[model samples]
Target: MSKLFLLVFIALSQRVQSFGIGSTLYCYQCVSTQPGCSPFNWFWHWSQACPEDGDTCVKVIERKGASEVVTRDCLSALKGVRTDIPADHYEGCKPAAVDVKLGNYVFSSIKELDVKKDYYDETTFCFCSFDNRCNGSSSLKVNKSVMFSLTALFMVIHFLILR
Candidate 1:
C-alpha cells in the first residue's frame, strides 16, 4: 500500500511540473480594416503568445463614429490598469462566449474608449476562443453583423426606390 501511495505522489508531481509548458495560448491581432488580419491573410502571419496568466484568446471590437478599433489578444491581456471595471485575470486557456450592450459599445469599459464623438448606434462585439490563433477567426464574426445590417439597409432602400 505504501509503495502504491508513493507512486501516485510521484505521478501527481510530474503532472504539476508539466503544467507550465501547456499554459500559454497563441492568438492573432490587428487593428480596424487591416489587410494583414483578413481571413485569408491571417494564416500566413505569426501569432502572439499569450501570457501565462492569460487563458483564452480574445477578439474585441469597438466602433465610435466612423472610426472603429479592433484588437485580438489574450484574454485579460491588459494588466495594471485603473478602470471602472477590473481587468479579467485568468490562468489558462478556456472556452467562453459573452455578449453585452452598453451605450453603443459592448463588453468594454465605457470610459476606456472616448464616447464623446458623434455616437452612431454601434454594437461592440467581444469573442473569446481557445486554440492557436483562434481569435483571428472569431474576430471575423463581427463582419457577419455588419453584413446583416447592410443587407437590411439595402432592402429598405430598394423598397423606397420601388415605391
Candidate 2:
C-alpha cells in the first residue's frame, strides 16, 4: 500500500508540473474615464494577468477635437468592438480604421486619410505580444537625437534674438 501511494503521488506531481508549463502574460488595465485616474498616471492603474488564450496586449487612444480617451486591456477584452486582427497582425502601432459597411478593422499610416470623420480625429492602436506591460506607452516615440537637435536650435535662436 505504501509503494502504491508513493507512485501515485509522484504521478500526480508530474501532472501538476506539466500544467505549469505555459506562463501567463500580464498587462496594464485602465481607462481614462476612471475617477481619480484621469490623465493616465502609471501608478494609478494595475497589472492583470491576461486570459489563457490572450497573448496580445493593446492600448487604444482615441482623440476628438479636444477630448481624448485612453484604454489599456488584454486584446480579448475588446472583442465586442470588433476589430479583427489577423494572426499575422504586425507588432507596433498604426492608424486604425473600421469599415463603415462591414465593420471590419484596417490600418493606415495616416488616420485622417483612411478613417471616417465620424470615427474621430485620430485613433491609434498599439499591439504587442513580446513583453509584459508593453501596452503601457505610445509606440511611436520621438528620436532622442532629433529632440536634442531641436533643443539646441531653440537655444541658439533664443540667444540670437536677444543679441
Candidate 3:
C-alpha cells in the first residue's frame, strides 16, 4: 500500500539526514513517562545530538506493574552508572534478565549496568554506535546496506504494481 511505502520513504530519508555529516552523533533522547517516548515514535522530532564523548546511543525499557517506562539517550549520559560491553558489539537490542527497571534505554553497546538494583517485572536495553539517532524504536536496528536494499526492492514492487 502507499501508506507502507510512505512510511519506509520517510524513515530512510530521516536516517540519511540524521547520520549524514556531523561532528556529534544524534540520538532520540526521551523518557517513556513523557509523551512520544512510550510506544516510541522514531521521528525527526526526537533526534538529539550526543555529547562529544558520547560514542553510543542507548534505549532502556522497564515494565512495572501496569505500565512501562522508556528512556533513550547518549551512553555518556549515564553519569554515575557504568555500562560494560564486550570489545565486540553490534547494533541491536539484546534482552537481559531484569535486576531492576531500566527506562527504555542502549547496549551490546553495553553488557551491564548497575544503575539501579530495585527488582522490576521486566527491563530491556538497546545500544548502537556511530549512527545518528540510531537509538530509536524497533530494537532491531537496520544498517545502511539493508535499508538501501529494502528501498530498491520496494521501488521495484511499486513499479510493478503500477504496470
Candidate 4:
C-alpha cells in the first residue's frame, strides 16, 4: 500500500516537529536599598508583619536612622537570591517583587541591597502571559490534537495508497 503511505507520512511529520520544540519562561529578582531611604519604598508595615509561615529574619528594622540602621532578612538583605531563568518571556510591569513557584512554574529574585536610612523590601520573580507560571499550556493543546490526528491519519494512508 505504497509502503503504508510512506510510513504514515513520515510518522506524522515527526510528530509535528516534536511539538514545536520545548517552550520556556522563568524569572527571579529582588532589590533592597536604604541610604537615606526611598529606593522604591513600599514595605506597608513589613507586609503586615508577615507571619503566615513566611518570615525568617535576622535583622529587621527597615528604618530608624540617627546615625544609621536599616536592616532586613532572608540572609544579608539581598543579592541575587538564587533561582533564575529570565529571557523576557513576560512582564509588563509590577515586578518589584515576585515569588510564585506554585507547582513548579518557577520564578525567583533577590538583589539590590544597601540599607542604612531604612528601605529594605524589594523581592522579585515575575512572569506573565496568563500568569500560570508558564506551564505547557495544556501540553500545547494536547500537542495540537495529536498533530491534527496525525494529519488525518496521513490523509487516510494517502487515499489507500493511491487506490
Best prediction by lDDT: 3
For candidate 4, give the lDDT of residue 39.
31
lDDT of 4: 0.34
In candidate 4, residue 90 scores what lDDT? 47
Instruction: Give the winner by lDDT: 1 or 2.
Output: 2
- What number of backbone clashes does candidate 2 have, counting pairs of residues 3 or more apart or in separate chains? 0
Q: lDDT for each of the candidates?
A: 0.50, 0.64, 0.65, 0.34
**Higher-scoring candidate on lDDT, 1 or 3:** 3
In candidate 1, list every pair of residues with a backbone clash: 55-92, 55-93
Each model's total of backbone clashes: 2, 0, 19, 8
> On residues 1-163, what C-alpha lDDT tens digit does candidate 2 reach at each position?
5456546755765543332335676678888898533455556676788885657888778888899888888888776554533344468777775455552464555766534345567778878876666677544233457655655675565557544
Off by over 4 Å in 2: 1-22, 35-38, 84-88, 102-119, 138-163
TM-score of each: 0.42, 0.54, 0.54, 0.25
Cα lDDT tens digits for candidate 1, 1-163? 5456546755655544332246666677565467665333665556777765546665555555766666566655533421222234333322222223333543445754644322324433344543456666544333445545655675565557545
In candidate 1, clashing pairs total 2
Q: TM-score rank, highest first?
A: 3, 2, 1, 4
What are the RMSDs of all candidates, in order? 20.6, 19.2, 10.6, 17.1
Better-scoring candidate (TM-score), 1 or 2 = 2
lDDT of 4 by residue, 3-108 (tens): 7767877776775554322332121112235432223233322221222132122222222233323333232123244322233324332223223542243233
